[model samples]
Target chain A: MEIFIALLKGLLPVAYLICLWFYGQLFFSADETKQSRWAKLSVAIAVCMHTALLFSLAAQYHRCPLWTQGEALLFLAWMLAIVHLLSEWSADTRRLGFFTLGPAAFCATVALSFLGKELMLDAQYRSSWFIFHIVASLAAYAAFSLAAVLAALYLTLHRKLKLKTFDLTFRKLPPLDKLDKLSAMWSFLGTLLMLASTVIGVWWVRRDGLHGMSPREIGIFVVLAIFLFTAAARRTLGWRGRRHAIWILAGFAALVLANLAGLHGFHF
Target chain B: MILNAPSQPQVFVLGANHLTASVSLRDRLLLDEKSIQEFAETLLKDGVVKELSILSTCNRSEIYGMAEDPKAARTHIENAWAARRNVSEDEIRTHGYFLSETEAIRHLFRVMGSLDSMVLGEMQILGQVKDSYQLASQNGWTDFYLNHIFQSGFHTGKRIHSETTIHEGAVSISYAAVELARKVLGDLRGRVVGVVGAGEMGELAAQHLHKAGARSFLFFNRSMGPAERMAAAFGGESRLLSELQEHMGQCDIVISATGAPDIVITREHVQGALRHRHGRPLFLVDIAAPRDIDPLVGEIENTFLFTIDDLKNAVSGNLELRRQEAHKAEAIVEEEAARIESWSRALGVVPVLRTLREKYQAITDREIEKWAAGQPPELRTHLESLGRGLLNKFLHAPTTRLKQLGEQGDGSRASYYADLLFALAREEKQHGD
Candidate 1:
């Protein structure tokens, strides 16, 4: 059982890397004016690879699959990329695969790096409420990651257009209005998930009353607060264009910093 | 068959276009019936030409001719144009391009197909060139070879345009005007359009406007007759030249294509129309050569005035797209031309192959007759049959090779084999005598 779990963990990163490379080649070499059949096929393969990795991790751990810090982050990144990839694929925006798949590959590599030892099975985390809290937090982080990608693309394209340097890359990007609307859409969904995750975390804290205050919970709460504030500003203050782009980038940066410090930094 | 026949007749084209000459110069050089007759008569009388035809359009004037002596014919045609148009010989000679033989044939095909037009791939030149050919034919000005070449040129031109997307989009000023109007107005249904002049350009613009679903059209011209005729033909109303301003105020779009020397519509006239329409957008299309509308009228709010230059800018982008399409069209033309050439060359080889086959079979028949002469009466027939079978086997390889060569357009082999077969038949006849 241990050997099969180790093999599965190792195969997950390899599969992710293959998916990333295939998607990059498919999108980067595609003709901008016409649909690419090869790109679609590559994306379909990548989706299957991601699904296989997700299933292997879930089956091997025999729990909610977020027991370890690396597993939690990796699961979150995989969920983010898969959700975005499926949505964009259905929308026929195959170009988004390059942005979303790259981060998923990075997270998968990080998860693979922690693959040698079995995760510490915490009896405390076996509770249904705790599992729900972890899942909601990770799912929220995944949604924010997708929003950050669209925000980054919007800023890049807006800068290029302002500089009056039209190029093939710019031409291949979605229109500024479309990118803005897409970013706002993801940000709205991410904000809602973050709020739900925060509520669950608070509820778990109130119900257990055994765990002491820690930097990880504080970091997650601060990140969630920032995302909620930015989403409100985007809607109420009518914050858009370059200003919205900056806020999105700042919120994503904060989340990354919190995740790294709370989860990956202590382990390494 | 004659060996080493002289090469076929050569062709030459000399012409000037809008780029090389002004509209005035082009119009002056344009040959009418009397002029073409006089020119043809002069050439024949002076013994300076073999065969010739003239093609003239708003953009170009060209003379296509065949000559036994190209140098003398070139000099004679240049001098003749100089005298006719009252220009210096050097001036006429410098602007005109002289293409001989294959180049001339290629130029004729290009010109008839509108590849050489100022607006590349415009369809008007094909009809114009066809008209010129018909006129030349009626005048008894062209011989058999010239007629065949012109007819083939027309056919090639039609094939190139139809089989490819070279003439798919708007390339001319009139077409660009219509395209811009459609873009600005979104849709032309229930729109009233006013045509300021009843000239050729105005007629074309009105036709496009009508096709775009403009409900009512009003025509105004310096002369009432042509305007009324155009309006009646299109199921529209005609307004008097004096009511131009009133019509301009009422119509949703105004297409001005006049030959007026000065600006016909001033800024004040447009401002007055804008007020009467209560801020509704008005599209003004000025397709006149010298520009009929005042250039300043474009500045008025709620009114969009597009002169020829503005239309040209829009057309310039589309011209790049047309150029790309033209490359595809050229590929199609090259393929078709090769197919035609191969077919014509194959026709040339068929007769020689037939003659060679007939001579070989005759020799085989004679040999069978001689072999069967001394056999027993009943056995003779069987012996002749055996001889015929042997002859069929002997001829199979050469016959297969000849047929393959004919299919592949190797006329050289056909001539060589024909000569050998003829020699064999002659030698056999001599030995028997």
Candidate 2:
């Protein structure tokens, strides 16, 4: 099991390294559509490889890898890569591969580096309900990461545009309003999914009397609250541009901290 | 001595442009397409220039051709311009820039590549050159040399176009408007562009918008006839100017260039359109001097408004950017010109090289028959091989060196080598005959 985990972890960075090269070409190369299309193709291949690795680990453990530390990290990176692919397709921005894949590579490297340290998970995690809830929560975090990357891009392009220095820089990005709309849409979907997952996990914890609600659970709820507030304010108070972008960032930041600290109480 | 040697019938070009001649002179020299063809026929008939092509745009008029008596051709062109424009021949000569041989070739190359155009890296000149070449070809004026020159010029232009970013950005006001639309709307495919007014600026804006991939175009003008005509040109429909309110909601963009003294589209009309659009972004471009759209309409959310001044600023910025690219394109033009000049110089010696090889083969065949007379079949084959191989090896060095000198564009040295080779061939012919 350790050998399998180690091999998969090793393969993850190799895929990421190839993806990084393609991302550089996509961002720094000419404005030809073919180059970006190939870059997106490489990213898709990497995601597929990561997915195959996750399935192998799942087959080895005889359950979903969600309960373990290294496997959970790997799953988060996998989800992030998929979300990034979604963004690349939806936004049609050739310059985004570097920003999107740079973060995914970091997540994957950290995930792969920390592999084989997963303590054998309990049979309780074998339940499909608990698996679905955790998967939902991780996917939410993935969507949030995609949203945060787009928000940062929006802010950067907005600054460049305001300065009237928009020659070749940020030329491939979607328009400001288009970026904002996408960010908001992703944030809404992420937040809604996170809330649904949180409710499911909380109900499971209570019904099974597994344990008390951890601070990680409360932290996720807080992130969800921020996302909901931002959505409501954008409609009601016309909160837009930097304010909404910042709100999404803060929520994603909270999720990151909670994930890295392993404060969701499944840690060994 | 100069009269004893024949002069080659070489291509020469003489021209005046906005740079050298005033607008009035250029206007008088303007030969439209059909007239330019007729002028070419006249030049051919007059026997001043053997082959002729006329390129006359609004800003420049250049007559390029192969001339048997180039001095007479220059005098004829000057006298013709003087007589036609009622100006002195000396005055016409002073205004024109005359070029022959290498300089003429380079100038035509640069013209085709648009390095010599008023707008740097402009694409219109390529088409114009192609048209000129086509006219000359159809009229049986162009020979192999002129055809080769034009085809090479076109290929060079195409290479420079793809290799440089010369044509990447928008440099004119109409194109700048399209750039702004693309910047704001990502891709304008499937979007509707509403053009209000039948003015030239409005028509140009609509045309640019159509080129930028706006699927549907709505033309609203007080003058119905021109509006429908513009709509027909764009493959779109036209409506009355008063119906802008109804059409505004469907349009992703609005370009207004009406000649009204007062504001035509007020804030109220835009607000109503905004309510119906469901908060999709709408780009409004007002190009009229007296301001067709109200300034207050710009304050509405999801409505981005720009004026004629804004477009001018964009045009200046984009033009400056293309100017930088033009510098890079100039380097490409210089390199291509040098390369073409080398090939042009080499073209003179092709017939001489062919005659030299034929002469060598004749001598070798005669020697082989004499040396292998009454020998066995194997000995005869050996003699033939020995003679042919020696002849090829003996000829190789001189052949390579002369080709090198030919491509170096030393016309006198290449001509001297050709004369020397022909003399040797004539000496060998005496022995064979």
Candidate 3:
């Protein structure tokens, strides 16, 4: 059973990588809209395959699982992609699939690399509050991922239009104003979700009698504060266009740095 | 079918115009409602012509008809015009020009296209030609051939206008004068206009000015009655020729259309008017052939004088520009004409080919029926089917080859194949009989 679960987990990253390749081709195609739709379908299939692998691992372990670093990474990546897909579906921002799916494949591959060894599971993680906190935090991160991609495309297209070197691809992207609106809306939702996740983490830590500030917890708070502050600055100054795009990139970069440092140091 | 060749090519065009004839002749030949109805009845009763139409306009009178013979049709038309005018046939025929079929067809095309108008490219002639044809159709004088020819001519005229820039600008002195006035003045709405003569040229210019939105029209002529008539037609007031200088001072634009052998509006007359009026721009159109307005009068401040030569020069210049654009349009017309001609020729060949095929099939059926009568009853059905199949198989290749040839350029070769096929079908029929 362990062997079968490991093999399935190994196949999940390859399936995600295939999806990433299809999406990359789709982005470069002349008929990008048509290719994007095809990419969405491929990603949906990849998500389903990854979910099945997660289920197989859980079933094989015969516990609530979440032991190996590989399993933890795989679960986090899967949750993030699933949350992004749901958000995109609700928001109708299918163009973000091209950018978001690449990172998703990268996370899946990294998770697969850490797939073999068992890790010590935190006792507090079994609590329902812990589950809600982790789920909300990952979901918030997924929305931020989509917001970053939109901001990048918006800035690139805006620059091209300003230079009067507008090509077919730039024309296919949503107008700059629409991109800004989407970015702001997604970040706002992500900040709210992160706040909810933070509150839930505080409740879980208290119930489990954990001591002050783990590196991962501190990283989460710092990243949450960046998003919250950026959102506030955007509202007050009416920050938009290039300025807004730069701040969004900076905020996403801070979150990535915090995640990498915390997750790698904690081996999570 | 009895093939009796046509007796003679009978073609006649009776028309009156400003050129080669005058208004007297045109008015004389103009058919009133009763006369037109009577003329149609008489022509049909006498068998004088098989097809006919009377095209009447303000400037010209024309009778187009096909008769048993050209001379007879010509004589009938001449007598009709003479009878209508109560004049001798000799008097009218001497001035009338008779054209043959080709000349008549080209003339019809040109007339419908407005190339034959007193003012070339005048749009009035197209509507006039259509109305004339409608009248003939109403009188039951238009036949299949005349209907086809006239309709095609009308279409050709439309094609010429749409495809070429030939009619792009005003072609007459009167219209060019109005066009220049409008161009200089922007809009003529509610502007006062003064006319100095009641000659045909001046009357035309005044009429165009009034149509362009002149609110008050004041006419002055040597004869007051004609001036009164002209003013009333345009809803304007008639002033005495003595009051012309006073009216000219008050008017925004002045048009001189007189047959004066000398300059009618001298430099002194215009300079006096310019003093009475606060320095306002005055547009002067002199449409007389012999120059009615003095050329020196243009030296007066705020006065713009346009002579007949100047207007004609503008007309000719615009006509040249239009001619260039018209060349481009002509290319389009030629392409479309060729396309339509090809389609028409292909359509004409289709019925002949169908008949030829039917004739061959009938003969083959007859021959097989004769051969089947000598066979046993059971074998007859089988033999009939076999013969029909064999005959179709034999025809398949040739029929396809003929259709392929028909699809190519100069499909007249298909008609020759049709004739050969018909001959073969006849010979087979004779053998079977």
Query: What digit string (tens of lDDT, one per residue) describes model 2 on residues A49-146?
Result: 79888888778867677776766778888888888877777776546778777777887888776676757667655677888797898889888888
Give candidate 1's iRMS in Å, 1 decimal.
11.2
Q: Please identify model 3 stretches exceeding 4 Å from their true place.
A: A1-268, B1-28, B46-48, B66-94, B168-175, B192-207, B216-354, B357-417, B423-433
Q: Best to worst by DockQ, what's the order? A: 2, 1, 3
TM-score of each model's chain B: 0.57, 0.77, 0.59
**TM-score of each model, in listed order:** 0.46, 0.70, 0.42
Best by TM-score: 2
DockQ for every model comes to: 0.02, 0.19, 0.01
- lDDT to native, each model: 0.70, 0.77, 0.70
Range of the 10 consecutive residues with the lowest summed lDDT in candidate 1 chain A: A29-38
When summed lDDT is taken over every stretch of 10 residues in candidate 3 chain B, the lowest stretch is B1-10
Which regions of candidate 1 fall more than 4 Å away from where they truly are? A1-30, A33-35, A60-65, A90-92, A128-131, A205-209, A264-268, B1-433
Give the number of the best model, judged by lDDT. Answer: 2
Ranking by TM-score: 2, 1, 3
What's the CA error at residue A243 for candidate 3, in Å? 46
